[model samples]
Target: MRLMFLGDVVGRSGRQALVTHLPRLIERFRTDFVVVNGENAAGGFGITEEIAEEFLDAGADCITTGNHVWDQREALVFIAREPRMIRPINFPPGTPGAGATMLTARNGARVFVANVMGRVFMDALDDPVRPLEAALDYHRLGSEVDAAIVDVHCEATSEKQIFGHMLDGRVSLVTGTHTHVPTADHRVLPGGTAFITDAGMCGAFDGVIGMDKEEPGRRYIERTPGQRMTPATGAATVCGVAVDTDDRTGLANWIAPIRVGGDLEPAVPTRWETA
Candidate 1:
């Protein structure tokens, strides 16, 4: 199975880029399944129902989220109905929406998608490692499960890396999100799972994450909120990772970083097959 996991979509720029580029991207890569993190899709804070549908219409099979999942109250209502839209599994039980969903690719392969937020340097949520373990065990029990993708939404790189190691080989792919800065560590783990520290943000690269640079700069320099930070209205970049997994074992065969347009250097996935 060939899957693509996009990083956090920041605001209008991110959404616009996805709508503009994702369709072509999916065709170019021949991706079987696409997952995008939409936590920051609504004005750089939370995602809205409209934007979620836009992402799905643009070729995303599933949308994942992080701490910003609750920023939009409407999400609470829509999440219940949209099974492909997932929040952090580590949230308090009964939080809302399904944390993991089984999505079928166009080719009829069952793909298990999970979203988990890290406890370190973030919030007082449940242990991320535990939820990940449980999700893997639950899906691996059935032969119907073909691939598993885990979105480790987090703040600390070290924490994400640690969890990646813990889940190495157990899941098909483990990609990080929230930082909005794509790391250069895309690689197939020794255990065969594809991993990346962070998939980066799908917004302008010339600003503070995805927000306008002026407000954030002012807040940092003056230690006061002079104005509300808004999403930078500029050419945006779609950043993330692409992984190819073996059908029989559900392990990664190759992994590559994905960065298209904007200030960041361009990156494309190569056609490589492992023996």
Candidate 2:
């Protein structure tokens, strides 16, 4: 099974990049399933139902969110009705959206995708580990599910790493989001899970984490709120990772980082070139 996981999408630029490049990516990578984080798709805040649907239409099988999941007020209601869109698993029990779901890939493989938020230097939420364990218990990779992917959206890299290690052999992939910066540590773990501290944001690289530079710069330098932060409108680079898993074991056999367009150095998995 081949799976691709995209990081947080920031505003219009990110959405445009995704809409424009996703089809080509799916074809080039021979992807069977795709998961994307749409937490910051709405003008650098939370995702709206419309945008979430747009992402799903553009080739994402599932859309996951983080702390900003509720930044847009309408999400509180629409998320409950949209099973493809999920909020953090650690959110309060009565939260509107689901935390995990089982989806069938293009190749008829059953894939389980789960979203969880960390509690380090961020909002205090229920323990993410337990929820993840429960999800894995219900959907065992190679048995009940062909592949399992987990998105650990959080502010700290250490926390994300820990979570990834905890679910090592139990899941197919464990990647992070929310930081909007891609980390270079993309590698298959000892337990066969593909891990990356962050898959990075899909938006302009010229600004501060996909936000327009001016507003964030002023607030940091002047130490006072200047104006509302808006998404940068420049060309964007879609950042993400692709994992190829063993059909029998549902464990990652190959892992590669993907960065295309905009300011970042472009990369596509070498395996795709040969394919």
Which lDDT tens digits does candidate 1 get at residues 206-251?
8999999988998888997577689988999999988888888889
Give TM per candidate: 0.96, 0.98
For candidate 1, list the clashing residue pairs, or say none: 180-201
How high a TM-score does candidate 2 get?
A: 0.98
| Highest TM-score model number | 2
- Each prediction's Cα lDDT score? 0.88, 0.93
Please give, for residues 184-221, the per-residue lDDT of candidate 2 as tens digits.
99999999999999999899999999999999998988
lDDT of prediction 2: 0.93
Error of 1 at 114 (Å): 0.8
